[model samples]
Target: MPLMRPRMATARLTPSRRPHPVTAAGAKPAAASTMGGTLRALSLLAVLAAAILATGCSTAQIEQLKHSRTGIASGERVVILARQHHSTHEAELDFVECVGNALSRGANGLEIASHSDFVNGLYPWFEPAIAPLNPEELPALLARPGVAERLAETGVRYVVWMDGMTERVDGGGSLSCAAGPGGAGCFGLAWWETDARYEAAVWDLKHVDQAGLISADVTGRSVIPAVIVPLPFISRPQANACRGLAQQLQEFLVVEDQLTR
Candidate 1:
């Protein structure tokens, strides 16, 4: 029997175009005005780019993000999908395991599969130079004989698609200066800190089983902050974050049971 996709929700989340940083202070008023104008221009360009990219894609590939899948029906089999852009395969696999572990501990009626055999839909959204796979090419890949049969052998069902990000950590240091009686007693005190933060952004969610594709249900994106610790801190704090976020997502689905499939 063909799996039924979840009903589409009325609420949709449009991507934000807000700039991460505001114009630097200490600039002249005129310069600030110019900067604001530049920011606005960039924002418009971004909107246009998104519109173009979204024009021809299907609902699943475009607006229906389907990131975090929670509140699934009882006994629904589940599979985790992990992808990365410009990051090591090791990193991607680590994230997949983290997700699987979290779900296994908390979620019921779910099963974990091998990370090595997980889905890698080569969709266009992925940055080509770094991680070369396009989602558009997924159907063909799936059709390449024996794919679904193999997945059925594993008893795979739902998919939890994850995207990981790696950014350069900017180490920070602060200096202290004070005034004294005779001469200014200014001392440079450096406090070192790492600005590197890792986070997983859930980009796609789909419920696929041995029966076949289900209707695209939830659509939206979610973020889980990664952990970057100094020497004495835990190496991968992101695991806890992932578990927390997953639990939160599960709660969200429970609340929206009426709205989601």
Candidate 2:
């Protein structure tokens, strides 16, 4: 198989920024209580409205990679790997697992290799400390006779490297909580937004070159308001990101539609 140069592209969703009001000190207890109550009511209304409006909105975005035709065939064996640096996050592992499961179930009929199995079987040949190889490093690593034999024995043709993280980008508002003899209570309003960004690089081991790169970004906001009662709104940014990345991987690998003989 002839080596194919990798193609890369990026897509981003820019969040609209709004200035947050600075909390001021020396506010009277009565005035503060009144203001907090009013803000809580308004925040509750805003959360409800936003939830309804956001039902029709999607937070995921994908930038497709352009590359020459990969000689990959349907039902090919593929392994999904999370960068060693990214392996620290449980969410990252979950994302990779989602992608692998989706690929296995997609029309492409790809055989998704288990990450644990791949790591264990490949063993010292592909050290974990050195694993999650970048595109440039893959060719040389795969070119080694022992590594090549191990990969062949494992029947893995393509390797997908996933790296990135989701983080809280912006936050505002404040919520206070207290416990009384009667019960516990939380008051005021609080909210935060998160952005999930990840990139998948496809390496064709047979060709000893990178196939392409797929990038997905998902941003979502969650709001919580307390009006004697705490109302929590969840954004589910990680879930959205997982779905988007999985779908893009299916399309990028041309596995979305079944191949007809």
* Candidate 1 weakest lDDT stretch, 10 residues: 224-233
TM-score of 2: 0.71
Q: In model 2, which range of ten residues has the least summed lDDT?
A: 18-27
Instruction: Report per-prediction Cα RMSD to one decimal.
Output: 15.4, 8.3
lDDT at residue 140 of model 1 (Cα atoms): 55
**lDDT tens digits, residues 1-261, model 1?**
212343333323233322122311222242334445767445434433443333212112111222333354444445555554444632345655665676666534245555545444323222334432443444554565676566556454444455543232323333345555644322222222211122233212233222111122222221111111011111222443354445443443333333333
| Candidate-wise lDDT, in order | 0.36, 0.66
How high is each candidate's TM-score? 0.41, 0.71
